[model samples]
Target chain A: MDILESIKVALEGIWVNKLRSALTMLGIIIGVAAVIAVVTIGQGGRAAILSSLESMGTNLFVVYPSSRNATTPITRQDLITLEDVEAIKNIVPTVKAVAPTSYLSIMTQVGRQKEKTTIICTGQDYKSIRNLELVEGRYFTSEENNSRRRVAVINEELAKTYFSGESALGKQVYLMNTPFIVIGVVKNDPSNALGFGGDPPKEATIPFHTGETLFRNLRIQIEGQTYSKEEVQETIDQIVKLLHKRHRNEGKYRGYSLDQEVATANKILGIIALIIGSIAGISLLVGGIGVMNIMLVSVTERTREIGIRMALGARRRDILVQFLIEAVVICLVGGTIGTILGTGGALAVALIAKWPPLITPGTIFIAFFFSASIGIFFGIYPANKAAKLDPIEALRYE
Target chain B: MIKISNLTKVYRTGAISVTALKGINLEVAKGSMVAIMGPSGSGKSTMMNILGCLDRATSGSYIIDGVDVSTLQEKELAKIRNHKIGFVFQTFNLLPRLTALKNVELPMIYAGIPSKERRERALKALDKVGLADRIHHRPNELSGGQRQRVAIARALVNNPAIILADEPTGNLDTRSGEEIMDIFQQLNQEEGVTIIIVTHEREIADHTRRIVHFRDGVIIKDEEVLTPISARTTLAALPPAGEV
Candidate 1:
């Protein structure tokens, strides 16, 4: 029989039992929709995390001091020094910029408002090194750091809290009861690298020289040895060499790179996304099984019809094509509707939750083709059964 | 022409076998009207199935028009069914979802006739069966007699070498049954189309020029009717068209 005629017959069969056909297609629809939505949501999440990590400076490295002694603390000098930063930049050609930093939490007063916030003290080029942005004012100049001027930069949150209804630039804020002029209001950084929780830090910044002069005496112990200003580089070198030289400490420092950390986090997120997507794909498998079940029922119901066609000279291939087309039509229709619903669902969630949900063309193609294949795969047994039916037996069927 | 010798059909149901046809021998001339009469389970229906290429015999040497049907493949058998034989069932078997015209056009579609020609030939067939005005009427809308007439038109549409009917009037009342038999007789006598019908009624058998009696899957009697009644006269004796 002609293919068009077979299609017509299949369509007529579907039309004759509209409710059954629709119910059969529902499984495929939900399956495709779930697959599409889950994959899109996963993709959106990956993009969100990657962006957050990237905003922390893709090439920046952070090192924390470690000590075996319970009484020892990782002082700013013990962890890093100006000389080590210079040496790393010069000796390691790949190292771009390094700025040592120290922070302390102190209560500060601005006008009548008082808040406790962490204040960071770093070198002149700290802003450039950490990729900080200034929204309202400018960073402190090198001359200000050399002169030990009491100048500070406030983060956007701190600026909003202390300088509400007024510009924070050139304003005076009290840090540990010491008056300091705000040279700049820093832009809110996208990454929350230093925050204890997932939130960005609320803080202030000051020149490292000014911090050193105000704080007076400082000491850092490394491996039972006391390290002062001149010995800071020696302490850092001993720590690095000791950690790398000992076989017992090899695991602690093995492949310990910032890029590796970022890559590991990305890999973890990728695995989570895949797991969620596969769980959703189970619905598609169930839908395909539903198609197969409904097709079997349809063949049983249409036995007499099959017999009539066979009696009218329909070949086995014709019977096969007719039933197979019916199944494919159901799945194709379901896939199309599922894609639309899935995209709409993703968009609605993104809008409500305010998270970026990406729906790519590749996802659409995968969903469509996957559902079509499901139809064909599930349709085989029923089609074969119909094709193999004996015309005499079918005709005599009640 | 048709020939069958030592044709046997055994149907297996699990471990048991039922012989539907046993060593049947028969011959039919090119353009003759013949009817086979038998009781239920006498295997006349099985003989009809084998003759129409709807079933295969377990052992046989059956030839139609020159081709050995027993040696034909399933596809070749389907071709024979498509272009060499037309079937009229007692229940009409008109597709309920299709119109009378489409029901008649079904065979032509299987024959790969294009839509234009299929439509033309279907309409002409319906016209021959005196259902031109009811071409678009679905089976449920037509009376039993009209439905059976539509089946006749479908049988004629493919211009097959032989027309096979299995108890064509078994489901109809006497009047409608007589009307159907008259149409069959007209096709055989006027168009010179070879016809073979299986029926249990002697009156129906009398309408044809020859009768073959089947008993226990075997032919017991074969006789010729010297005085062949004119079917057109009987058809004319009925009420005019559209009066049922």
Candidate 2:
């Protein structure tokens, strides 16, 4: 019989035993669904991280103090201060902006509400360096940062929590019992940071010099933005060397861009996704075995039918093709359903996790073809068994 | 036309042997109707199986329409079965899932006929068997007589060289049996189709023009009926269908 006729016959057989066929296909459905969802979610996460990294600016670099040996402790002289920031701004022409930041996690109070918030003390250049967006009011000026003004810029989360109904601008937010006027409300950029479970903590920004009196033994984080990506490593080298020259310590400072870290993380993520996706594929193998088992049962059940077809002049190849087509139809149908469900599941997860769902056509194509191949691989034994039956004995079968 | 010379079939199971057909010689002319009748273990079924190309003979030169089928491989045997022979089983053997029309189209499907032509020829064959109105009914939905007629349509749709019926009316009532015989006789007389019937019932065998009796795997008697009983006359004499 022709392929079309064989497919029709297969479909008819499946239709007659709809419940049995569906039960047999359950394994494949789960297998394909898991593979698709896991792979898609993994890709989506990687894409989100990469996009966030790009949003942070590829030319941006961070320089922090690092003790080369465990035996040597970092002294106050090695800390990044206004002088080092000045030297980088004046000496490094490649550097666009140099912003020094200090982080202090402390309790803050606004009206009757009290919450723990990370206060980031930095210069006005931090707005451009970190690519932060101010939704309301303006950032504090350089004069305010240099004169130790107690003005602060709060993230959207803090503004929403403490000042939900009213504007946060010009509000008195007390940090460690010291009052700082809210100068601006910056939009919360989740991509700015990674690996925060559930929701990130509330954050507020204050002037750089204003944190000196409040913080002791402060380890400052220096952020620099360059005009282009090509000058990032050279500019980092220049700043690190400048710090080393002033501190009289060769390896007292470390500098790197986010691009290198992102690449390494991407490689690791890809490997991890592959490993997890392959683990999911083991179920597909089991599903293939289930298909084979059902096909075997089907062949035995239809022995009489095979005999009748043979008597009607069906070649052995025709019988084989008929059963093989039935097996493939089951798997392909299951695979199509699984693909849709998996993509939908991945989208649901992406919605909750706040990331885009990334599913490629190639992944779907491979999945479909893989399922069909499973059918063929698992179908051969049963089909061959049916094809080789003695027409006499088969006709005699009850 | 078929010619069998020294046809023999041996069955071996774990050193035990049983010869189903032993040195049997038979000849059947084209467009002739014949019946092979015997008791159980008389080898009539074995002869029918060999003649239908459903089984290979152990030792014989069985020729059908100038082709030496005894030495043919399974593939060539299948081709001959598809093109030159049709079979009607005692149980009807129609695919339960198929309607009468689709069942009739089965042989033609194996013959690689196109769908449109297969449908047209299947309709014609069903009409010839007087089952055109019941073509949409499945086998279970059909009466015993109607189901037999559908089987006949399926056997005839491919227009093979010979139509083989093994106990064609074994499961039917007297009236349905006679009606089935009437269609066979009509087809044989009008279209000159070669037909072979395997039946143990003497009454059924009387409707054919020739009878071959088998005993102990051998043909004991082969004779031509001087005045063959016409199934049409028998069916007409019986009570009208659905009254008995």
Scoring only the A-chain of each prediction against the true A-chain gives TM-scores of: 0.73, 0.89
* Shift of residue B101 alpha carbon in model 1, Å: 2.3
What is the per-residue lDDT of model 1 for residues A213-245, given as tens digits with 9 covering 90 to 100?
766542211111111223433444444654334
Best by TM-score: 2
Top lDDT hit: 2
RMSD of each: 5.8, 3.1
Please give the lDDT score at residue B54 for candidate 1: 90
Q: Write the per-residue lDDT of candidate 2 for residues A1-398, one digit (tens) a residue.
A: 78888888789889988998999889889888989999999999888888887887888899999886324778887887778888999999999998988888999998789999998988899988889899899999999987899999999989999999689999999998899999899988645545645665689999888887777656788988999989999999999999889888777888879777788778988998999999989998999999999999999999999999999999999999999998998999989988998899999989997888788998899889988998899988999999999998899899
> Tens digits of per-residue lDDT for model 1 on B12-59?
999999998889999999889999999999999889999999988999
Q: Is the docking of candidate 2 incorrect, acceptable, medium or high quality?
A: medium
Error of 1 at A324 (Å): 0.6
Where does model 2 exceed 4 Å of error? A18-45, A67-82, A245-252, A268-290, A337-360, B15-17
Between which residue pairs do clashes occur in model 1? none
Give me the iRMSD of candidate 1, please.
1.1
